[model samples]
Target chain A: MQEKDIFNLLTDEGFCNYCLKTNADDVEYWENWLEEHPSERENIESQKNLIILLANETAAQVTQSEYQKLQRRIQLSKKNNRKIFPLIMRWAVAASLIISLSFGYYFYHKAQNNRQIATTISNKTAPGSTKAILILANGQKIELSAAANGTIATQSNTAIRKTNDGRIIYDGDSKSLLYNTTITPRGGKFDLTLADGTKVTLDAASSIKYPVSFTGKERKVEITGQVYFEVAHNAAKPFRVLTRGQTIEVLGTHFNINAYDDEPTIKTTLLEGKVSVNYLGINALLKPGEQASVKSGVSDIRVKAVDTELVIAWKNGLFRFSKTGLRSVMRQISRWYDMEIIYPETLKNTDLFEGSTPRSANVQSILRKLEVTGHVKFKVDGNKIIILNK
Target chain B: MKKGLDYINEWDAFVQAENEAAFHELYCHYFKYLSFIALKKGFPVNKVKDNINDLFLCLWEKKGQLNNVVNFHNYIVSSFLRKLYRKENLEIDESMFVETVPGLQTYPSVESQYIAQHTQDDLSRILKIFVEKLPDKQKQMIYQKFYLGLSYKEISETNSISINTVYNTIYKALEKLKIEIGKENLSAFSLALALLSLLCLIYFQKIS
Candidate 1:
């Protein structure tokens, strides 16, 4: 290839898709071309690096809120830098010994793809997309995904509109409070804006019920499965989320609630502002960056600090698993892929998955990653994923 | 101007004058690189983010001593790696003979072509067969040099092996991959030709 041709390839989106291995056809074409033109290897490599670097930098852009959190961490570390210098020195000496021993472990386990399995199948179960069902108070149903980008429905003088960008908005005023429920089936999700201006994102296999207008003293919504809320501030009226056995009351804040019935506990994670989580007559106040977990049939609510990003990873289009168990991981995959997981009762493993992947990945890609652990295997038969022990 | 020169200028401003803007520029430049590297090395994202902030804070505080550093890119990268792995001699002087102007932007892309594709399902299946067949020591050497983007000298230091062994292992493994891929493509080409000829025969028979 000519130098100019190489430059064109560097700037081409096809080349980027090849570099990231996102598109299979692009990858095949590039690999074949590289094999034919060995002389352009150096140029190809450098350009590929530039592409990856650019992509990485784009993915790593700190949001305005995240930047403030990072600045705080840096400030705290600066204050403790001097005091911790000698201590870090002593710890470094001890850590080096452990590191040397662990170096072999890290190397051996880094690329451990021992048992290769066939991943490419003719049919693929794609990841979830924007789709949901809206139920009006009068038992009328609107399939929001197929509805046009305009007023889909109206309830009590409130204009229910669907934006072109796939968001359901409730505009205008309502004299009477008529409730509406938005439900997302498996392999589907939807975004909604309540009359009070609270923005809500419904994850797959989830539902949220809210009023057409806030005529009462408070804005309340009941949710199932997982939902993220960014409440519009109203000092006079408190915003409340009723989920299963727990109730979360917030004055205007961002939070995520994972209250799937299959899950062991209903977790309400607060991202911004304050909230009070009530479970079984016990109330636990939560500050920003805190989580309140209410277990089934338990009288008390446990509060702890958590990484809110991981809590709302679904809303951000990411599957971030940090020491998450196999069963839990499979549950997430099942919801996203809309597949039934069939595993034997005798199948019990203690493998903790630790990785992150984009939610836009296919079922095979997700399963392939899990297979890299060498502890589990998956056989995708039509709409079912059968987990096998290694 | 090249990206390396931009990085070098930012490094100089931060080290010599303690310019906060330049320091922030350098931080933004390497933050994702370090974060991705740490994550690849199996560090949790939250911990990696915290460690990156701490690493930059310490480097900022100690910028006075960072002057006179010849390769600012290598210095910052190796320092972070050493701190991360808790090993002292993770530095690579093998690329010392190369022109210093090119800086850090060149090496990370060298062998990551295959390493970057290690995540794709089909590509990784092919890599698994070849990489799993290699000896343990050679596999580690290839991984350190290619996947981790470490230099030969750094690999030798990390694995306590000779630089010659690191070079030979990586070189042999890469050659094997090239040969294997070439042979596979040759077979695929022949198969395609055979199928095309068969189709031609069928067309001629139909016309006849």
Candidate 2:
């Protein structure tokens, strides 16, 4: 084969494809044929050299600066990657913190309003239910549950009267005074009148221990859970309420205490007269229609103006929900209608609703209204309401 | 066998550590011959140096992960060629290399072809400087075809250019390099060396 022939053979499209595509068998055949052609060997040799050279030529050089820059970029990217998780975690924590804080604050204010309403309504009607342990000053224990509904017993100096309103009142002609303690339980509410004629309304899941009769420098009560007070005027003896984590000192004032153990914060609302609230080592004197809150272990006390009717709505036999979530609404429902709440996962994301319903309204009616407004559905199974997805 | 594995592991650890001295030693040991092969394939000098530097850096990054690299010289040469072809955006069908050379009437047996063996050290400082001078595009094309061993079709596909254009540009670049390097009275060995070095340099410069 001439040089021209060899070049053409190497460069021919068909031959190139065959060589590139075929196996060792085909390559061997070509190798044998080329080996047999000794006369045109040099030409074949040069063509082979050119082919080899083409194959060998492949790599390109890079500049020092460019290489250094790429290395730097890769390193920087790796470093940045490490910070991503912490940054995301911080944002998540911050967002949840804000959300929980807002929710807690809103509920605190709302509960105060509910307590106010509950007090006003509770004073007007017969108390719904109560579990109060009556302790006479002489250390005699009378379980209120076992005693008759009215006028259980009387001390020699004081008249221990149980009114139709579920209050244990002491009506004394003289200035005789005696002390007693009434402790209420979960799913229980009660009313009482002190010897000084101070009216007290206790909410469900609550307790209050006070004097049966008054003839002292100060009228004081120790309480838990929730209660509304209408203290009789006593210029000398100031009325004081001691609860978990705080104290409320009043002078001829009407107020409420919400110190439920499950509750994250303690609340005190002043309805009328002067009262000083002390919480988390901080003290604030409150006028009527003012509420104070202490959250967690923090001493940050927040006082704000409030509507008195909304705060005391619960005592009025009305279920009031103000910007309340599904969980909170269900909790209230579970208590009132005496039902178990089972919520589906999807219902957890439901929007908050604010409204009021009479306690006389059945469970189904409240659920139906909620379904209409929030686009959620519920199934009533016996005493259990299963909240479902829309 | 365990001792061999341990040695390999140690070597990998050293590479991962980015010991510049070890890389420089490896360069000195193999770059000259590698540069020669690159130049013969028609890469410019600067490109050859750049390609070598990139390879070393890559090797360092993937130190412990390196495998199937029995012949470091051939591996580098092949790797360089592949990078060049990719850089130029060439789409050479790999199957073609196994096929016969196009436009040839007769071909020599593959065994008889004088494919120069490249060493790591052959790629040195002088070759790097030489490649730096070439135009960017020319350097890239030369590296793609020669160093990367990509076919014109692969180059075209990668670079988003016509196959015909890849061929013509490579042809033009080789011719220009041959003329430029021919002026020096370098030994035939160094001439071949210069050719490879220059091809890599020119190709890299062009692409960059």
Candidate 3:
């Protein structure tokens, strides 16, 4: 580079601005210019120092009154220019609804013929009711459904209560830790509140054994069959649920565990917070709306996202099935209706049901809904349901 | 420095949503920087405040046209400078300027010299002594560029001189530093290289 060109650059207004780092464009231009003129870098840099030496004084201050005055002017200017119109949106909504209703009435009858089917059964099997046998640590049984709403028993200083809505509550602290087991038999479901204030809802044919008062560093409970729990939040004393094949550790979260003995895999579904599901040597962390399943005697714990509403439908008094096999649906029914489902050798377990019905419906109505699909028929012989493929 | 995304969103809210809150944020962000520039450019402190208001008011009026501005900081700084320089016949006394760099008044304590060794202050300290010996006009121009954070175009307009003259004066001042530092057994090449690195550091952290 010539000395005159170097001198020209040193005196250039944009170059001086670039050196002081004021104008973004000048800075970008000089940087690119420097990159291309590698040989002239030293000369160009000596000049940059002169300009850089003068940059960045602490900025002058703006008073509060100055700020408020400018803000008010900006606000007033915005209000003067803005013109609002809300009527167009309302008109658009009304017109779209009228168009939808006219199309709906035209096709209403055509769709009705194929949708409705009627069936009646002479023998009806009522759905599961709120009933459980609570056994105290000292070999005493108290029928929960038959027991009146009040404090039924006191263990160590804690009062065991039965709410009018069929929920058993264990209130107050106990000096000595004692364990109580609540078993929901076939054709029955129950709700229980542990001494730690954790709420447990046992599905049909499920059982939970918990301490009358949680002590030590953790609150631990053992469960069998399907159970939904809203564990009380206690960060210091972590809540742990022990199933047949898995141990779930949580610090206050809503989760459901399906660990029924008849099922091949133990599934733990987390609704909120975090829960760690550990089965044998395999460990899985479950986020909300995620299910962790581990098969018996298996080392791999599979984690997948599942619709939680369908998983906890039983607790909400509904039987929801989506691509669920015949065997799986019957197992849930068997627990609810106390009926044994016998699938013959010729029957295909592959028949999947995709529908939901109220759990309060009679067993025959639930079966009729499945039979209407024309894949299978049920022959009810007292408490036994013999499944025959159509 | 505030991120680019925050400025972009504030601009969008101010223009599209017509949010007064976003307008207030943008007004405050540039108020100090612009006010400093206006005052350095020879606008009296009282007039600098109102001049800043007029500049922002003009910006708000033309906000629709400014929606597609790519570099918001450059656009704002240039616009404010342009507004201040619209009139060509402002009287500014070049000799009346005082040399007071806001943050450069450190008395080199024993601990500071130890800590600032091979640091920015240490490198700048070598040039600071040389800079102070420069003639009043040259020293004030360099101070406006470095200490006061003004562009060469701003310094030219501030002194009512041509941009070329502003460059020539600064060029002469730098040549003087190169010769003076060379006499001190510090090669101009090495000192300039060190200064170049410091300039890049300042370049990246430029908030205005």
Predicted structure with the largest lDDT when compared to the true one: 3
CAPRI band of model 1? incorrect
Global lDDT scores for all candidate models = 0.69, 0.59, 0.71
Candidates sorted on DockQ, descending: 3, 2, 1
Every candidate's DockQ is 0.04, 0.04, 0.07
Top-scoring candidate (TM-score): 1
Estimate, for each residue in A343-369, the C-alpha lDDT of model 1 and write its tens digit.
Answer: 967875666555457889788867865
Once model 3 is optimally superposed onto the true structure by TM-score, how far is the C-alpha of residue A82 displaced, in angstroms? 42
TM-score of chain B of each: 0.41, 0.37, 0.41
| Regions of model 2 farther than 4 Å from truth | A1-150, A164-166, A173-179, A337-347, A379-386, B1-208
Q: Cα deviation of A377 in candidate 2 (Å)?
A: 4.0
Model 3: CAPRI class? incorrect
Please identify which of the two predictions, 1 or 3, would achieve the higher DockQ against the true structure.
3
Candidate 3 accuracy as TM-score: 0.45
Ranked by TM-score, the better of candidates 1 and 3 is: 1
